[model samples]
Target: MSVAIPIFKPVSQMQLTPGSTVTIPDVTWEEFESILQELGEKRASRIAYNQGNLEIMVPLPEHEISKDLISDIVKILLKAKGIKYQPFGSTTFKKQGTAGVEADACFYIQNYQQMIGKRRLQPDDPPPDLAIETDVTSKTTLGAYEAIGVPELWIFDSGKLAIYLLKDGKYIKSEQSPYFEDIAITQIIPDTVERSWQVGSFQALEEFANLYLSIIE
Candidate 1:
C-alpha cells in the first residue's frame, strides 16, 4: 500500500503580512528553486534558504525606507571617491545545493568590471563585495551569506549599523568597512539614516555629503 505525501503549497498561494516571516522546514534545493520561480522577480518578499530550512520575510515600510537610505549613502560615498560600482538591489544569490539568499541591497565595486552586462551569476563569479540587510522585519540569516562567501555584510538594526567581514570561512564583526576604511562608516551611516527619518532623505543626504566631503578633505 502506498501512503499519500503532503504537497507544499505554491508560494503565490500564501499570504504573508508586512514585518512577518515564515519558515518552511525540510525543503529540498529543487523545491526551493521552484518556489523562487513562483515568487517571481517583482515581489516584495525576501527569501533565504540554508541546508533544508527556507525563510521568507515581508519587510515593513520602515525597513524599506531605511535600506534605501543606507544604499543611497553608499552610492554617494562611492561617487565622491570616484569609485565605480554596480548596485544589484535584492538580487537572489544561490550557492547550488548549499544555501541561497536575496540581499536587501548588494554592490559590486572591486569586481564591477567582471559583472558588467551580466544577468545571472556564473558559478565561477565572485559574490558581491558588499551586502546590506535591514532587520526590521526579521533577523537576516547570516549562514546563507557565509555559505556563499560574501566578503562584507552590513546589518542595520535598532538604530545602529553592524559590519561583518568574512575571514577564513567565517564572519567577524568589524569596526569599519574595508571599502571605506578611512571613513567612520559605522557612526556616519547610522547618524545619516536617523537624520533622514527626522528631516528628510534629500536634506539628510545633502548634509551628510557636505560632512563627508569635509572629513575626506
Candidate 2:
C-alpha cells in the first residue's frame, strides 16, 4: 500500500486546494525514464511513481543547506583542477522506486570515459567515482546504489560528512576511495567551509580561482 506522506514538496507554490480543479499529469515509468533522453542533463527534480506496487514521492532537493553548500564547493575545486564530473542521484533519483536518489554532486574520474562505447553506458557499469549526498542520513539513496552495486558513496550533514566504500557487496566506513584520494574524509569537509553557501561563496571560490589562474601562468 502506498502512503502519501505530508512532506514538503519542491514546487509547493502550486499547492492543490479544495475545489481548485488542478490538472495533474500522469505518465508511465518507461515514459518518465525517456525524459532523461530528451533533457540531455540529469534533473534535480524529484518525481513520483511506483515499482512493484510500492509508492514513492521523490522530489527535487529543497533548500538543503548541506547539499547546496557541498555541491558548489566541490564544483569550484573540481573545475579549477580540470576535473570532469556530474551531480547525480536524488537531485536525479529514479522515479520508479529504483534507487532514484540524486546526490548533491557525483564525480566520475578520467577512467569513467572507458564505460562509453558504441552506445550509452551499460547497466553493469560502476557508479560514479564519488557520490556526495546531503540532508537526511537514511539509506534510502544509499540503498538504491547498493542495489546497483556502486563502489563509493559520500553524505554530508549540516556540518559533518561521511564517506562509504563498497566492499564485497556491502559498504564500510573508510577514509578514502581508490577513485579520488582528495575526497577522503580527511580533506572532504574541513572546518573552514560548512554551509552550502560557503562552498561557492564569493570570497572562498575567488581565492581558489586566483590560485588556479596563477598555476596556469
Candidate 3:
C-alpha cells in the first residue's frame, strides 16, 4: 500500500471586506449574477459589476456621513425649489447582458412621475435621472453607469462636488446640472457641506433651504 500527498498553493483571488474595494477582472455575466445571488441583499448593497469586471466596496463612516448629508441637501434644495422628485436610495440598477451598479444615492427628478408607487424594478425600467456617489476610499467610474444611461452623476470627493453629464453614450464633466439647469451647485453645495460638519444636519439643511429659496425667489 502507498500513500500520496497533495501540495497546495496560495490562491490569488481578491477577498472583499468593509472599508475597501476589491476588483476582479475577466468575470462572466453568469458568474457575476451568481455572486450577486450569493450576496443576497445586505452584502450585495456594496457591489458594482462592469463588463467582465467586479468591484466591491465597503463604506466607511465618513463615506456614509457624506453620502447621507449630500442626499439630504439635494432633497432640501428640491423642496425649496418646488420641484417634484422621488428618492431612490441605492437601488440596484441591473441591465440584462450589461453591467450593474449600486449608487450611494439616486433620485428621479424629471422622471419621478414614471416610477410612482412602484415596488420592484425590472431590467428595462428607466434609469434614475441623477445618481450621487461618495468617493472616499475608491473612485466611482462612469463606464458601468453609462451602460445604464444615467443622465446626471454627482461625485462628492475630497470635500468637493463634481458633476458629470451623460451625453452620447459617454460622461462629460459639466459646470451645471442637467436637472437643475439654472442652479450653481459648485457655488453652494461645498459651503453647505462644510457648515453641516460644523452645526449638525438640521441647522445646515435649514440654511441650505434658505439659500436655495433665495436663489429661486
Candidate 4:
C-alpha cells in the first residue's frame, strides 16, 4: 500500500511598506522559521515571533536613522568610558518552543567576551546585556524580550527614550540605563536625534561624542 504525504500550500510573501507591521496568527515555529528563511536576511531584518503569532515590520528612514545614531552614541560612550562591549545589530535572538525577537540593536557590555567565538547563541547561554528598540512606527512590547530574559532594554519613541530594567521576570520602566547608571538617555538622545537632521548622522555622532566628553571631563 502507498501512503500519501500532505503538502502544505506555499506561503506568499506578504507585501510590506515602510513603517508598517503585519501579524500572522496561528503560525508554528517551523512555519515561522520557513518564513524567515524565505524572506532572507535583507527582508526579514525586523521580524518577530511570539508563541503562535509572527509580526514582520518594515522600518522607515526615520526609524533607521534614529536607531543607527543612537547606537553610535552608545558605542562612543562605551569607548570613552573604556567599557568592553560588542554590538549585535538586528540579530535574531530566539529560544525554541517560546519566543524570538530581532532587536534594532543589541549589545554585550559586561559580558562581551562570552560571545566572542560563538556563531549562534542558545537559550542556555548568556543573553545580551542590552537590547534597543527604535520605535518610530511600531511599538515593541516587552513580552518578546522578557521571554529571552534580556536584562535591560532601551526603547526610543516619539522623541523620548525610555529605559526598562528587567526585574522579577518583568520589565519596569526606569529613568536611566541599568548598565550605564549615570547616563540619562532621555536627556541626551532626543536632542541628538533632532540635531542629526540639521548636521547629518556622522556629524551628529561627532557632536554627541564631544558633548559626552565635556560632561565626564
For TM-score, the strongest prediction is 1
Please report the candidate that would top lDDT against the real structure: 1
lDDT of 4 at 156: 90
Across residues 48-166, which tens digit of lDDT does each residue of candidate 1 receive?
99888899999999999999999999998888788999998888998999899999999999999999999887888888999999983333379899899999999999888999999
Candidate 4 off by > 4 Å: 1-12, 136-141
How does each model score on lDDT? 0.89, 0.51, 0.79, 0.80
Q: How high is each candidate's TM-score?
A: 0.93, 0.55, 0.87, 0.89
TM-score of 3: 0.87
In angstroms, give how far residue 113 of model 3 lies from its true place. Answer: 1.5
Better of 2 and 4 by lDDT: 4
lDDT of 2 by residue, 90-171 (tens): 4343433354444556666654576444144455555666677654445444566565555677765556666788888788
Model 1 regions lying over 4 Å from their true place = 1-8, 136-140
Superposed by TM-score, candidate 4 places the C-alpha of residue 71 at a distance from the truth, in angstroms, of: 0.5
**Candidate numbers sorted by TM-score from highest down:** 1, 4, 3, 2
* Alpha carbon lDDT at 127, candidate 2: 60
Q: After superposition, how far is residue 27 of candidate 3 from its true place, in Å?
A: 1.3
